[model samples]
Target: MAELSDGVAIRTITFSLLSSPGLFFTFLTIHYIYRSYLFPYLQPSMSPAHIGVAIFALSFQITNGIAIGGWLGSYGPTTSSNWAKHDLSVYLGTAIWALGLGLNVWHDDILRSIRRRRGVVEKGSGEKVYEIPTGGLFEYVFFPHYFTEWVEWAGWWIVGGVACPPARIFLVNEIATMLPRALQGKRWYVSRFGEKKCEGKKAVVPGLI
Candidate 1:
């Protein structure tokens, strides 16, 4: 959004700066950079379906970014609206974002440490290991990473305030898409470890899903 950040209010500038790559730098970007080493079992070759999904996801993200950027630059709040009055929201959002990101990284590290200890694939057999995650929020939910991501974006929405449709849509869309995937992941865990082992853990939400 550097190209569009000429004369936006300080609030908008700060919001964009934090919510831009800062929202994902701790997880998504880092994860993708080392994805090959981390997930050696994944094929190097991309299928047509993979390409299609990538195109669609990229397009959607770019469109969403533009929408949010445009709103922050022109259509949304400015200093004229007495931004100081809304400081609470921005402060609260920043706290929530940090908390969410910390939890996400911690949970991810737990899984990675497990992989490091147990090894990703068994020798000779070439079978992948699937361990049930423990520690922190994993004791309550199957997909704490996904849940914390939703939390991160929920903070994004709060920082943008109630009037920002783009921020609301962004957070809502993330939940809508990730929720089903989290559910599927829970089912996969159940299939792998059996229903008995996964009895207490919910999909994404604790005691809910």
Candidate 2:
């Protein structure tokens, strides 16, 4: 096997370490899409607008993966003794990302279970109405999955270093999109179940907004 630093520049190693989580998340998304077939109860018909949004989202993910990966791989590995220290942030970030991924998957499973248990089906216009999920992270936040996703990308940005332009941009985009979406979801949940059921839960954050 080739040595870890063989043919890889120090900067490349740093960049790769930072960028690896993005690629991992991209692959995880693909895996989720592939495995979606196993969960027929969770699938819903897509409207033209929904399809457009899906395509755009997928394209953006692909582009983000490419940009980060390409930038990292542009240089070769170097024979540097300081690689371990440089990789500290990467390792920490990966751990956080993994935690977030687990939470996201678990929350999704809970949502799916709720839908199946309630025999939820799509309406004539492809609308799905789900009961309030009060289990798992949903007990704390109205949109725990989205919150975990933000945590995952926050880890990504940390791994890439806060100064890295691409990572910063991605983090900004996530905040801009997810925050509003979570707020809207919170509103919808309150409207459905009234504020009593959602008494203690925040929109995305647990203790703070």
Q: Please, what is the TM-score per model?
A: 0.75, 0.70
Q: Write the per-residue lDDT of candidate 2 for residues 1-209, one digit (tens) a residue.
A: 33232455334343232344444345345435634564344543322557777798899878876866554444221323333444676677767767876787788778767665544455444765668787887878888888887787777665554555666778789789889989998899899989898898899989886
Write one digit per residue (lDDT tens) for candidate 1, span 1-209: 33334565454434333443233223334433444365344333222557777788889878986886577566665443444555678778767866876787677677667766555345535875668989999999999988887787777677667677887898788889999999999989999889999989999988898
RMSD of 2: 5.8
Whole-model lDDT, model 2: 0.65
- Regions of model 2 farther than 4 Å from truth: 1-49, 75-83, 120-129
Candidate 1 positional error at 155, Å = 1.0
| Candidate 2 lDDT trough over 10 residues, lowest sum | 74-83
Whose TM-score is greatest here? 1
Q: Please report the TM-score between candidate 1 and the true structure.
A: 0.75
Q: Alpha-carbon error at 191 in model 1, in Å?
A: 1.7
RMSD of each: 5.7, 5.8
Worst 10 residues of 1 by lDDT: 20-29
